[model samples]
Target: MAQLRSVPSRSGRGRTLLAATGLVLVAAFAQAPSTALAAGGPVPAAPAADGPQLSYVVNAVPGAVETRAVARAVRAAGGSVVVAYERIGVTVAHSGAPGFAEAMRAVPGVQSAGATRTAPLRASGTTDIGRPQKVDLKQALGQARQVERARGGTAAGGEPLEPLQWDISAIRADRAAKVDDGSRRVTVAVIDTGVDDTHPDLKANFSARQSASCVGGRADTSPGAWRPWDPASDYHGTHVAGTIAAARNGVGVAGVAPGVKVAALKVSEPGTSMFYAESVVCAFVFAADHGVAVTNNSYYVDPWLFNCRGDAGQRAILDAVGRAARYAERRGVVNVAAAGNSAMDLAAPKLKDTSSPDDSTPVSRTVDPATCWDVPTQLPGTVTVAATGAKGLRSYYSNYGLGRIDVAAPGGDSTQVPDLPAKNGNVLSTMPGGEYAYLAGTSMATPHVAGVVALLRSAHPGASPQEIQWLLKLEADNPGCPASDATCTGTRHVNSHYGYGLVDALDAVRR
Candidate 1:
């Protein structure tokens, strides 16, 4: 019997604590069994030494059109590779044969050999029902809740005490004064775990033009695909879509561009390997081909975990993402990607013989993970977004470096306090089945910036992707962090940790 498992819903608060406690301490969590998939495969008799037991990984030849020949090779090698996810163009397996790694590498059309791993699709944490928060003028523009809807009630002490509600109307009004938000519809292609189209806020953002479910073709825009309140595959994309373009309707949370359209593209999920670089490339092609102006991706794979053996498979994927993004850029499409949540550079906690920062003390040094960071995002031609706390400082756990991160966005964690206009508690958006949820990560932050790009595209219809990126970088507000925080000295202009600075919607629009 095949072991099956549902994706785990991680508490955002718990994950923030786990990530911030310390890099050395956090390393253990990275090796923990990924909660992104359902659990019910063949039980492993013994686990691997490094982390959880890894099942077989099948490699497909780069640029090869024959997926069957690749599967046949796996079968001939005594590996039972099944489930060809056309979205990413890879296969999964039960186990590997002796010397299977070497044999797969040698097989024609085979790119490389590795194990199939899962990633967490939902953020972990409970909603702080009693935490005190501050609402800034920017977030209070269009206050939705009158005295009656407040937590306490219409009388004294009845304001909604938890799940901080951001006044999307206020944000919209404030932004509108600076720019025009006409019916200029911008389409964002979300390449991640499928989306929850039934969610009220999200329904407004989804487009009727065309949406496809690569999640075995079983998923649709209906509420049933996501049972109860959540779906078994991935709730990541839905939350992201909501943040980017949840409708402006007064039903739920408002997205950055609530009036814009969202193109749902399922590229990540449980029981599936990440879409190869080629698939990502193809996604860019599809997005541009379909008038998608902005592409949001929140999924990544540890290159080292797959042994970092680059072949045609890797090159094709990289070429697809890079070339396609470039093509999109020329065509006025903006690609927004996560800088990855790993605290350190690509090599991160484990640098083999290389020197790593001492966890006991906050340190700063120049390091480039492009050579080692996960693929697609790290590839050239796109904007890589990092996370920021409520105080306009870089999150302790966000990966940093000038070369890697292009800008910073509000990816709130529990430790984040409500700082003026910025709320670090959580960004609430639509979930599956017409529900609302709170999730945070670089995944969450990418869409925030992507939505901003959409808004920019709306105002400046002919703005090139590179020009928009330059405008974003140039107009970013500098949250003066003096030589304090023990992390670095001097003013952080374009550091990796915080990038140019936080995405100032107000500022971006004014530009």
Candidate 2:
């Protein structure tokens, strides 16, 4: 499952309650808009707390909730239960009662209860703090600043393009060597966290006219259904957008296609880490309905196959994605998605391996046997991207399969290319506020292809999305197999791990 949660520690009193309500509480946690509960199972109960605690998960049951009864029982036992959402679930700030556990356990309809998981108090072993090394704000701003100056002014009114501080020239050279910047203008839709239209690098590329925000529920602030910006997750969307198409001039890290127009859509709400399936679908629909040349999806949905074999919610969302992709195709738009960072082959048939990569043996990926359909990476009409390291080798974390992955690019690697400042490791772009930040994962790889698509569109304005996808795959470079593995998959030609080999910018443009 791709779900992320901040569970409370089970070592304390919470552990006692875990045996009864742990699984139920988790099942009732907040779900994406398109997510449906595992049918036929008992509705899950909300978690309990000892002190003033906040529950991120919200229950979905209609009318009155069980917590109210439990709270009443607790009061009899000299404790109080505070209903949070009131309709379906409640948040108990202080389980204010003597024998809190004993009282709650006796309540009717109460099956189980426990505290959530907790984060480590302090970092001791191997956990890196803050953002990864590659994100460099100064460099990104410097680059953006330079571009802005070159354009004769600052800010959007008459602002010069911001110059990034990173080595975008290297990336440009790498791609240009294979393809002349085919088209100066490319359009990509950012489908993750809502973007900050006011950020420096982002402002220049801000398609204020084409942007929309679904997170705020406004659907479209303008006649077209664009939402207003919410400040919670302020820099995330801008950071991602900057990485793709921040204007290039004298400053900041040059975008893969600096001149490309970005249709900014806020799918993830501000402050919230998780986005709803409905939000994703809405964004996809918006992009498909409009004429976005390419759409980049950097987020992944948590697997729900274990709970529901034929989840209507899951199918609804998948259907939306497929329809949107096909619709985009009709409009000559291409969809690019990130192969998740779980270090597994998304196309693999089942889950088997668990060991990390050994020095002598290649690393392996794990799949959920429970998944009934082809994983999202294998979905039709989308180009699933794999990440490669600085040495141009497949990234240890990149998901692969000749049939699934369509191409590869330099997304940076922490283990193999640790020498490059965290900001530069496998990194090749600008950050928010005109700074540069090194980021890895398929998130970084997807934009490269988006940029390539832009170049292809620029070179051949009339080209269809499928045609561009075909040309890139057709022109990719297959890294030769090692002498020892002559019988390996993709030994002589395109394989799953590397796809059609690495993307050659110059070659793609020339083609």
Candidate 3:
């Protein structure tokens, strides 16, 4: 069966968390069973969400004029508006009333309406992580520094862990940094779990003005609103932020686009850590409206692993997120998303999905890949990224497809260890509490590409989103498919396993 594939990465041989579907948590997940076609059948129709207090996304035409009409209809349908994102035609609502979605769907300008989750609302707890070690990489990095320090030459006056960050050299970001470290004018939004901007490596480049928490389908701009809900467990966003733009401040580690600014638009729910539809919609709209130049989405819009269009509720969630992504692109925000960590052929026909409604007990259902889509990443205009290892081959857990993947980058692989200090093959980056850790997933790969995109945006300030994406594909270094794998297909330049090939940060800046 197609189970939830959240492969979490840890600190010091620990795991990194990938929330919802296509994620991390310190384990390998296999693809659907071989009997998928034989056992899978059409999914049963689900009743309208009229039983419990659930969040709903009511999409209208992108304009206040049309949004006003839908808001009025939402109230009449016994629902209150959580937030109305007129910029992207998405209005979030909370309603337990019978047929709330059905009533809103009947409204004149409404395009789509559906409940976001099966689990009812509840407060999740946050953990108090132990105090961070005193900031001193000299003693902590003892011997590994002396060994790999010679191999990993200093770039932008490199950080202490630069010698251990084999992921950086895997994509040639170290060389790219010399040409251009990116511009502070551009900001890449880490649209995932909250980020710990207070981390030493991230604070210098963290833009508080552009950061906000879009947790409950609403944007909260309070102080540290963008910080992680639980630093110990929710360090996913912080680790991701570190890779994208953790600053080249000779402290711990350097990010791919060290000069670029990073903003956190957290969408994951506190306790559940699920990336719901309404929060995702808010993130896209927020990134677009803000001065963000790029957005990195490491997780799929959840509950559903692959949301099928046949289901009315799933279709609405897909449409709402699609609109938000489209809106961001139109406003010059090029979005980059991870191509999942399930190791499934996204281009192939999918049969059984056993991960829908992940917040509650899930039931198996038949799905068509042609109609069922992975949000943000598979959506048109978004960059779908696959993961590569230090050896320059596809990461064992990354999802790939002939036409589905846009590019590849080093996410990391425990099996493909290089002669580096970290010893753990996972990508090294800043964790919470001013510390550093190693994690691997397509979740880690997306940031490398986003960082390169940030460099592109910096070098070509006049380029449009489409232009940046085009340059990204053209600049990649394709290694083609590995010989041992016969399941892979496509040519060297554009294959299922590597897409446009490994992302070249060095080329992103100079070209």
Q: What is the TM-score of each candidate against the true structure?
A: 0.63, 0.62, 0.88
Model 1 stretches astray by more than 4 angstroms: 1-174, 182-184, 215-233, 270-282, 302-331, 345-370, 419-424, 489-492
Residue-by-residue lDDT tens digits, candidate 2, 179-208 = 453343567887655565555555666676
lDDT of 3 by residue, 1-511 (tens): 1111123221010113333321111111111110011123211223334567777888777775776676667667776666667666777777778888888888988877888876675544321111112234564476446655565644447677777788888888888888899999999999877889888899999999988887776677789989887887677788889999988877788899999999999877766457788778878878887889999888777677777777778889999999889988999999998887767787877656665666666788777889988776779999988887788888887888899988988888778888754456778788888888776778788999999999999999999999999999999999788888986799989999889989999999997
Candidate 2, residue 422: how far the Cα is off, in Å: 7.5
List, residue by residue over 1-511, the lDDT tens digit for candidate 1: 0000001111111111111011000111001111111133322222223332223444453332445555556556555433333323344433324554556668776655543322122222211222222233233433423323453442221122112433232233225423543234678877665577767676656764545433321223343332222253245567677777766555555577766788776543233323333234445555665688888866552212111224333333343344556656666778887765545444344322121111112223333333333444565667777666555566555556545677777665557665322343455556665655555556656777787787777777787888888887776655645456544323558654656766666655665
Error of 1 at 382 (Å): 1.9
**Model 2 stretches astray by more than 4 angstroms:** 1-130, 134-185, 216-218, 222-234, 302-309, 352-376, 418-423, 482-488
What lDDT does candidate 3 reach at residue 271? 61
User: Which scores higher on lDDT, 1 or 3?
Assistant: 3
Candidate 3 residues lying further than 4 Å off, grouped into runs, are: 1-50, 122-140, 149-156
**Candidate 1 Cα lDDT to native:** 0.48
* Candidate 2 steric clashes: 69
